[model samples]
Target: GLRNYVQMFTEDPRYWRSVVTTLTYVVIAVPLQLALALVVALALKGMKRGKAFYRSAFYAPSLLGASMSIALVWRAIFNDGGTVDHLSGTGGWVNKPGWALLAVALLTVWQFGAPMVIFLAGLQQIPAELYEAAACDGASKWRQFLSVTVPMLSPVIFFNLVLQTIQAFQVFTPAFAVSAGKGGPADSTLVYTMYLYDRGFVASHMGYASAMAWVLLVVIGAVTAVLFRTSRSWVFYASEGDR
Candidate 1:
């Protein structure tokens, strides 16, 4: 019964590689996406005109989301001798072992609209008077962002962090399509879900696949729990302060 689980860590070197690859993808993709989204959200928060248009335009990519079509388009852009190579005069990124995972991660980072919108909403909830007070106190914009914006937005940041982290762990289509359903050129892009799919469907090892699913769930839960635990140190809650 537990043989499949045991084999995943003990017998299967590939699974270990896949786990590392998945973590690398999540660590790279999620932070970049959140950073981009937060920057956009901050810029949009200051804009006085055509904000809706810009928001819609920025958000269009998230609407495209993780579809096969989007993934295929991404693959073409990064694939060897594809559009990116034509423009940059370099070999495509999708084939290189070190660069392939980053290439796939870029696709997800490009769709930063969802978190950007959430950040914008959170920005809207923050009081402008707080900024005015910060300005009056001779706080630099950077200082204001650190003292006022981030502390106030910590809840929203934490929320988006959890959301993006969980989503990143489950990413499938981008790697699948970018590598043509093969996490190659050397399994550098072999994500957890992609490998799980191989075990479940491609190889018909249903029991092993199910075990992998359980492992994923447990990992997600454990990571989420750790986030919640550590968040107490930095995550702010005005309600708690009020009480």
Candidate 2:
């Protein structure tokens, strides 16, 4: 058992590729996704009309993000001679390693609706009096946002950060479907879970796959622990109650 686990790190180059690819997704997709979501949430919060319709419209993508149909649609859009290439006058991005990964990241980033809703709720919960006081102090809109908006939103930001980071690491369906279940054009889009599926199902390497699953769990757990440990310095709660 232990030997098989060790061999995954030492004997398998594909394993390392999966690790790097998953980290790439986490690093590239999660922050951009959250940032866009926060911006949308802030915009929605400031709107006076058609709020429900706009919220639902913005949220539709997250509802269908994991659906097989969306993946197929994405594949069509990025495939050779597809819409992206047709519009850009460039070659297909799907078959290229770096570009393919970016295409997959784009899919993840597009599904920011859930976090946006969460942020919207969090923004609403912040007392308007805080902003009023900030404005009374002659704070500009940008300064008020940096001081009042962000501090109040810290807890929500931390919540979304942890949840999205975990979700990003587990991203499999987009890569699997976009690559047509092969993680191909040279394993560039082979995320960790995709590789695990290939190992356990396609290659029949159940032992190695199981080892990989456990390692992934450990890695996520360690990262989460670090986040939680550091959160005390940044994540603010109104109920911290004095000092």
Q: Write the per-residue lDDT of candidate 1 for residues 1-243, one digit (tens) a residue.
A: 686479666889889888999999999999999999999999999999999999999999998968999899899889878998999887899989989999999999999999999999999999999999999999999999999999999999999999999999999999999999999989999999999999999999888888889999999999999999999999988879721
lDDT of 1: 0.93
- Consecutive 10-residue window with the lowest summed lDDT within model 1: 1-10
Q: Estimate each model's TM-score.
A: 0.97, 0.97
User: Residue 78: error of model 1 in Å?
Assistant: 0.4
> What's the CA error at residue 64 for candidate 2, in Å?
0.6
lDDT of 2 by residue, 108-193 (tens): 99999999999999999999999999999999999999998998899999999999999998999899988999888799899999
Candidate 1, TM-score vs. the true structure? 0.97
**Per-model RMSD to reference:** 1.3, 1.2
- What's the lDDT of the predicted structure labeled candidate 2? 0.92
